[model samples]
Target: MNPYLEIHPEVQQALAAGKPVLALESTIIAHGMPYPQNVQTALEVEAVVREAGAIPATMAILNGKCCVGLSQQQIEHLGQAKEVWKVSLVDMPYVISQQLDGATTVAATMRLAAMAGIRVFVTGEIGGVHRGAQTTMDISADLTEMGQTSVAVVSAGVKSILGIGLTLEYLETKGIPVVTFGQDEFPSFYSRHSGFGSPLRLDSAHDIASLLHTKWQLGLNGAVLVANPIPEPFEVPAPQMEWYITQALHAAAQQHIKGKAVTPFLLKYIAEHSKGESLEANIALIKHNARLGAAVALAYRQF
Candidate 1:
């Protein structure tokens, strides 16, 4: 066992018993959402996972421990805590060594989930190539981590605020398969359609499980991106999302928000501008992904 890893008893038991276990990221609690809603959504998502017949292991860092499954109290603390370190791949070691309260980004979560032997991960959205990356070169570490980590990520697709097309291209270049669930078109986080064809498509948890089994059986490395679309009724229209994103981007620039701070800033901006509709959409998609992740984890265990 890794000394740095503090696996919750429930998660440990599930893993040892060969039962399904779904890994969930914690950035959503620490920096992604606001106040009581963040805590509420975190608890709700865990329930969704458990209802699907799997254990939910929410990953975070607290007081130098790499916590695999946080309790409800820890979730609330992370949600209300200010200035929590949004730890990614590069910052993970520093946060742990320094005993800082840290939230795991997609990259950090995937890395730690793989370390803890959890194969399926759920998140609202995976970061990607930021808009105008040619000059700024502001690609997210999530992409790089996906290219190496072996966990299967269930998400609503890349944030619409990013270059979705470029993100797909980058994933392809990295030899990471991007499989859309029950859809031929790639989703755009808040929207159901990104106007791009997905590289692959799978309709059921069994299909995804089989694909993952085959891939790893052939000695393939890296993560499988399961792009689960946001539920249609909850989806914000592409045009409306585009407008909101543009407004948010302009404001980010004006405020000089850069680096890791950019995403949380933009998400809050969009939520506020959309009159909390975006936040609702975000919570909905994450819970939806949690269900799928649990199902996939169960199916994977069969192989």
Candidate 2:
């Protein structure tokens, strides 16, 4: 166990009993959505996980501890607080040492979840190579962490604001398996299709669990990227989403948003400019991922 980690009693029990537990990131609550919606969605996602027969451990940094499994009040505080640091892999030590309120990004959350021995993690979307990474080298630490951590991540695919094709190439270079659930095409967060064929496809949670088990059992370590498409009805068309993403990227550049701040900034910008349609899709996808993550975790437990 990590010296800085504090697992909730329920989560600890689940781990001790070898039950399914899904690790969730706190950045979605604190930095991904606006006020009341953030808190509401966080709780609702947790409910979705429980309904699917897995315990949810929503992780964050609170008062110098890497707190796993937050309370409703704590979730509310994270959603409403104005000063929560958006902690990524590089910021974890500083935030923990300073005793600051911090919301863990995909990278940080995955690392913490691995430390706590949780195997599956759920999130709305993951950060990836920025559109112009060739010059700026602005790749997200999420990719690097996934390359090293043994946790399996279930997301609605890479955020549309990133360079999807390039991100896929990078993942291949890192030896990470990119599997799309029930689809031949890889999804781009807001939409059900990214125009690229999936490198791998699996149709059920049991199948995914089998893959995870085989990979780790054979000493092939590192995370598996499970891309779950947003429900068809909620999907924003790829072309329409690209326009919004372009505008958001311009706005981010104009504001000089860099590093960890860029994602939340771009997400907020798109949500606002799209008249909340994007936000709704974001919420729907996360809840959808929660269910699948739980199902996979449960299946993995059987192995």
Candidate 3:
């Protein structure tokens, strides 16, 4: 009878029990990884969340409504479908009104997660100000959404391809706290160190949850970005990824690629040029982030 969302029975049960539930974005299935592997990684991430004692809710847009948790068949189809729309916060109205199929980006996912009463969201990276944003005047809607939404986003960090320094500054200006887990440095998506100090660091999930609790108790809007670095063995060396990023940026300039097309193109180029290391690191970090996200949700439940 819920017109706004198609809630999976398992997720509904978890909600009824007051158990922790972690929200997952669907873009990673639709636009992030290759077909079979995308589905496989999605399942693996859910398994990790379950192992951490939280329910997983993968969100997508389907049949003119937000789907709070997709079935495995739907997940597989989303992973392989080339026509899946990249649904962001702005895209929700179109997807709903037009009755189109779509996958939720970080901003959209956060909105849907909150609709489902889910407080924690897991993603490989959250978008921010693009490189050369002063000239391009481009910024992701995710940043603004984080400034106003009440959800906790767990990510490795922003993608290395973006201007992380500006992103951090922008989040600070918007009053969104950026917290890194067990480290002084924020992480690059494909590597361990992003070369910038995190504004705050907490050694444990309980500490992070307490901060989130205090923020809400004080009636502050906006989300907290919890940066959990990928394990050392799983990360690519920073200098090595930098070379690939530089080369990809040059190629983008040569081809005059701009706007949203720029990110996918550069990522694809790096994936191929790095002999698929970027994609491998991506999978590893996503799984790592999912585990941390579920842990955060669990701690939040205790609070």
Candidate 4:
């Protein structure tokens, strides 16, 4: 056990008993949504995992401890706090050594989850090759982390704010398998289609679990990117959402938002401008991913 890690008793017990456990990121709670909605969604997502028969370990950093699971009060604090650090892989050491409150991004959460022996991690969507990376050379660390981390990440898909085609290409270059659940077309976060074919497709949790087992057992290290589509009723059409994303991206560039600040800024901007349609879609997809993550974890444990 890592001295700096503090696993929740429930999560610890579940691990001890060889039960399925799903790791969830704290970035969604702290920086992804508005106050009350963020807190409410966090709790509901956890409930979804438990209802699916898996323990939910929401990862964060609090007072020098790498917390594997957070209390309700802690979740609320993260949601409402103004000074919480948006901790990514590079920010982990600084946040922990400084004993500050920090929300874990997908990359950071996967690292913590792997440390605690959790296999499947759930998040709304993942950061990927940003738009205009050809010149700016800007890309998210999440992709690099996915190339090495063994924890499987279950997400709606690459965030529509990014270049989905380039992200898929990058994942291929990294030898990271991108598997879409129940669809041949890769999803674009808020939308059910990305105009790109999925490199791999699996229709069932048991089949995905088998793939995870086989990949790792064959010494193919790194995370599997599970693209779970949002429920059809909640999906925003690709064309409309793309227009909104273009507007938001322009806003981000005008404001000179760079690095880690870019993602949250784009997400908030789109949600506010979309009249809550995007926000609702975001919430729905996270819950959807949580359900699938739990089912996959349960299936993985069977092996």
Model 4, residue pairs in steric clash: none
Candidate 3 achieves a global lDDT of 0.90
Question: Which residue pairs in candidate 2 collide?
Answer: none
For candidate 3, lDDT tens digit of each residue in 8-88? Answer: 999999998999999999988888877788999999999999999999999999877799988899898899877788888
Estimate, for each residue in 1-303, the C-alpha lDDT of model 4 and write its tens digit.
999899999999999999999999999888999989999999999999999999999999988799999999999999999999999989998999999999999999999999999999999999899889999898888999999999999999999989999999999999999999999999999999999999999999999999999999999999999999999999999999989889988998899998878888988899988999999999999999999999999999878
lDDT of 2: 0.94
- The model with the greater TM-score, 3 or 4, is 4
| Per-residue lDDT of model 1, residues 12-31, tens digit only | 99999999999999999989
Query: Which 10 residues in a row give candidate 2 its minimum summed lDDT?
Result: 258-267
Q: What TM-score should be assigned to candidate 3?
A: 0.97
Model 3 ranges with Cα > 4 A deviation: none
| Overall lDDT per candidate, in order of appearance | 0.94, 0.94, 0.90, 0.94
As a whole number from 0 to 100, the lDDT of residue 73 in candidate 1 is 91
Residue-pair clashes, model 4: 0
Q: What is the lDDT of residue 123 in candidate 1?
A: 97
* TM of each candidate vs. truth: 0.99, 0.99, 0.97, 0.99
RMSD of 1: 0.6
